[model samples]
Target chain A: LDATAVADAEARQAGLVKPAGALGVLESLSIQLAGIARTCPPAVPGAPAVAVFAGDHGVLAQGVTPWPKDITAVMVEVFRNGGAAINVLSRACGASVTVVDIAVDGDVAEGVGTGAEVLSRKVRRGTADLAKGAAMTRDEALAGLAVGIEIANRLVDGGADLLLTGDMGIGNTTPSAALIAAFTGTDADLVTGRGTGIDDETLNRKTEIVAAAVARTAGVDDAINLLAEVGGLEHAGIAGLVLGGAARGVPVLLDGVIAGSAALVAQRLAPASIDYCIAGHRSVESGHIVALQQLGLRPLVDLDLRLGEGTGAALSVPLVQAAARVLNEMATLESVMAGPDA
Target chain B: LDATAVADAEARQAGLVKPAGALGVLESLSIQLAGIARTCPPAVPGAPAVAVFAGDHGVLAQGVTPWPKDITAVMVEVFRNGGAAINVLSRACGASVTVVDIAVDGDVAEGVGTGAEVLSRKVRRGTADLAKGAAMTRDEALAGLAVGIEIANRLVDGGADLLLTGDMGIGNTTPSAALIAAFTGTDADLVTGRGTGIDDETLNRKTEIVAAAVARTAGVDDAINLLAEVGGLEHAGIAGLVLGGAARGVPVLLDGVIAGSAALVAQRLAPASIDYCIAGHRSVESGHIVALQQLGLRPLVDLDLRLGEGTGAALSVPLVQAAARVLNEMATLESVMAGPDA
Candidate 1:
């Protein structure tokens, strides 16, 4: 973002009809939007879309989450049919959703097969159980990230001015925690949260598995290598989405902990890539807060939400749009005031 | 409100193809809307509007806010010409703006005369300076409240699903702070804030004036008496608007400190009236948060805003409508789920 453009936008905002900065964060948001667009009034983010990355976490075999792995494929099917939460929310937000089966346990061609209903980008059925060994090879991680980058390019090229990150994999939050703790060097138990509301025993085991994964995954020099060791395919994909968005200078709205973890790695890959990211909402997960703090980003909405799949991200679309609109549309102070600035 | 309707909404929300409470405050907001509409799936709130109460504060002469009292009339003219901040934002939110001249110092009939340009509801020229004597007689306050109630009745009867509270008054934040501190027994410095970015000297004087007014206004016992003592005519009107919204079961989104202070008085007038109230944003004014806390209402949006005239409230109309749409249109978990609880 150009500093002079941001400064110009801020000066313009102060001159708007209302008391200076009375619109609050909306004013700041508009200024940022202006800076990003490099104009006093940038184009409103048009044709927003949420891309949900689906993949199974092999850690589910460790009794990490009570959900059946089959639930993952079924939920993807639900998203495909527009019967899922993200589907409903995206509609409410006036946005579209695309479900990408990068590493789901099911076959897409035999399942909800193609023509935008589902993108068949499966790198593998699933990764090995991380509690037993390395989750996936570094090459597999690179492939998943590449898949995400390709999808990001496709979505933006297809006319999505705003991209939202969504995730659909049971027990994915476990790896999200693992990734966060590994990158931030935070404690496992402190950062771990119950994925899909698991009971005491499951949560304890999930935390233990996360700790072991972090211990095994520590000292990975590259962000992608860390993803290969302890992160889910969706994490690599979302990280790639951030990279692509930054590379294209498009804004990406991040969902909860999963997206936050990916953002941490994306920040490492390209330090300035975090600039394109906006934390959509704060989730109930402890690690989510840690990730946001480390990134120095504030979530627009704090709804105590734990559901993933870009539901939180989709909800904030109106806010972001309003920010731009307020800047673009409101009458300036000079236009309204009769005399000089004294 | 119907308890059964709220229960039904909550149950439906839980099964709305998302994790239980994943939508967070939106889920709860939907349930509340359902209860207000007295149905399981309430009607989507459509066509919102802001009725901005324009008045002048006698506190202007006491050296509180720096802006001239004439600015109120000038801004009202701006609103009439549809060139004000409120007008621009209301249009952006897909809502109309109605400027009601309840106690503006200027003559509306002569100034912004004729047509539906401005609603003539002026109770008097303006209230008396608060630091010296009572702002208005009890009867005048009742009359102002009555005007607000009639306006509210007209709005909802005329097909506005949501009515937002707006105000146009230069130096009104002083009375707002006085009203809040009077009602809540908060200290002067604790509740007073620099309205419109006043200098330190003015803020200190404003704080002292607020303290004196609260002392004089103490033991009024009745809500109307408190209004008569230190409240602006717009304050009484906004309180009446809250009462009117409650009587009609219409949701009223409140602006910044002025609306917050008015809501404090409204909640006192009718304890259950606060149910119809929603705080739009947290203002920079310390009194706004104090009032929200006193009323036990959480603001939907918190941006450090001090501008009045329903700007914050109008920005939140999009959010309010989205919440309703989510409840009415989202698919149920049973519709998407493959099998049973397992």
Candidate 2:
């Protein structure tokens, strides 16, 4: 952010129609946008795009979630057919949805069928069982990261002013919590949550798996090494997406815990990647708060949302755009004071 | 709120793409709209219109606000010329602005000029000094209420699916604080805030004025009596607008402290009227939180906003609309289960 641009924007904001900072965080958000664009009024954000990275987690073999791992392929098909929550929400925000098969170890080809396009970038099969051993090799994690970076480039090149992070893996939340616990130094028991509303017994088993994963990945300070040891493939993909968007100087709205974990990775890789990220909503997942706090991000909305489809991020598209538009559209107090109102 | 319709809306929500209540407050809001419209999917909210009620407060004599009373009339001219925050925000949300002279004391005709059309429904020149005596007579309060009701009726009949409550009274926060303290049984010192950033002395004086008004209006169990004795005419008008919107089964977005106070008055007048109200944003005013809590309304946005020009309500129009559209346009999970994914 430019100091002179920020000062200028603040001076202009003081001259707007109402009391200074009366719009709450929205006022500061607009000023932030102005500084980002280095203009008094930043360009109105173009239609947003949500990239739902679909991958299967090998942790499903650990009974981490009640849903079958096959559901990942099923949900990917659902997303492509425009019948999922992400699809509905993205369309509502006038945003496009792009599904990428980063690493789904299933009949994903059949899921796409003929004439249905899909990003078949598989970094090998689904990640290895983190509870038993490493989730992926370092090269595999790097492959997923490259796939995500490519997708971000395509979305931004397609004229999207903003990118939103989404995921579609049935048992992904378990790894998300493990990633958070590993990075934020939170206790596994405290950060773990029941993904997809599991029974108490299943939740306990999931917790133990998360604890094992965290323990296995301990002492890993490198971002790629940490991800390769325990993080899911989609986590790496979303991390790449955030890094890529920041690299382009575009904003990326993060969904709940999964995106938060990815953001932790991105921030570790490039400290400034956190600048492009906006936390959309805090979810029911306990790890979300810790991950967001570790990254120093404030979510826009707070509610009981645990679905991992970038749906929460999609909901905040208009709000983010509104913040941008307020910079351009609102009349400065100087303008109004110089007019008949003064 | 119809129990059957709410239940039906919930059932429909369960069938949506996400888990039950996964969409957060939006799911509950859509269900509320369903009950209000008496349909599975409520009518799509039409383009919104903000009725910025401009009034004057005789309480300015106490030096509560540094701004002159004439600024109300000046902002009305600014609103007429589309050069104020209200005008800018309303347009940003694709909503129109309707400047209503409920009881502004200045040269309002000069403010509106000869050719411009404005709603001139003044109940009086301004409000009486609540510090000295009753702010309004029973007849004056009723007249103010009627003016608000008429504007509500006209706006809704003119095809506004939602009515946004706004006010442009310089010293209005004083009355708003008084109303909240009185109705919520809160301490005046607790609920009063520095309107437009007052100095220590002015804030103390404002607090004293609020305490005085509350003490004078004590034992007034009747809602109308309470309002007539200490409320500004714009407060009564805003209360009437809420009542009218409820009568017509339309949602009214309450701006901040003024709207919160107004909603308190309206809810007292009709206990069920709260069902037709939506809190726009939590403001910097302590009284706003008190009033919102008294009415059992959760604001959609929270920020450091003390500006009361319906700007908060205007900002939330798209969010409210998105909630409504999600219910209508989203494909049910049941529908998707029958598709290729299943």
Chain A TM-score per model, please list them.
0.95, 0.95
How far residue B113's Cα lies from its native spot in candidate 1, in Å, is: 12
Query: Candidate 1 recovers what fraction of true contacts?
Result: 0.57
lDDT of 1 by residue, A202-283 (tens): 8888899999989986567788888888988998889989889877777899999999999998998888888778888888
Q: Look at candidate 1 and tell me the lDDT of residue A281.
A: 83
Docking class of 1: medium
Q: What is the Å distance of residue A121 in model 1 from its true position?
A: 1.2
TM-score of each: 0.94, 0.95
Q: Count the backbone clashes (under 3 Å) in each candidate.
A: 2, 4
DockQ score of candidate 1?
Answer: 0.58
- Candidate 1 stretches with Cα past 4 Å from truth are A109-116, A339-342, B109-117, B338-342
Best by DockQ: 1
> Lowest summed lDDT over 10 consecutive residues: which window, candidate 1 chain B?
B108-117
For every candidate in turn, the CA RMSD to the true structure comes to 3.0, 2.6
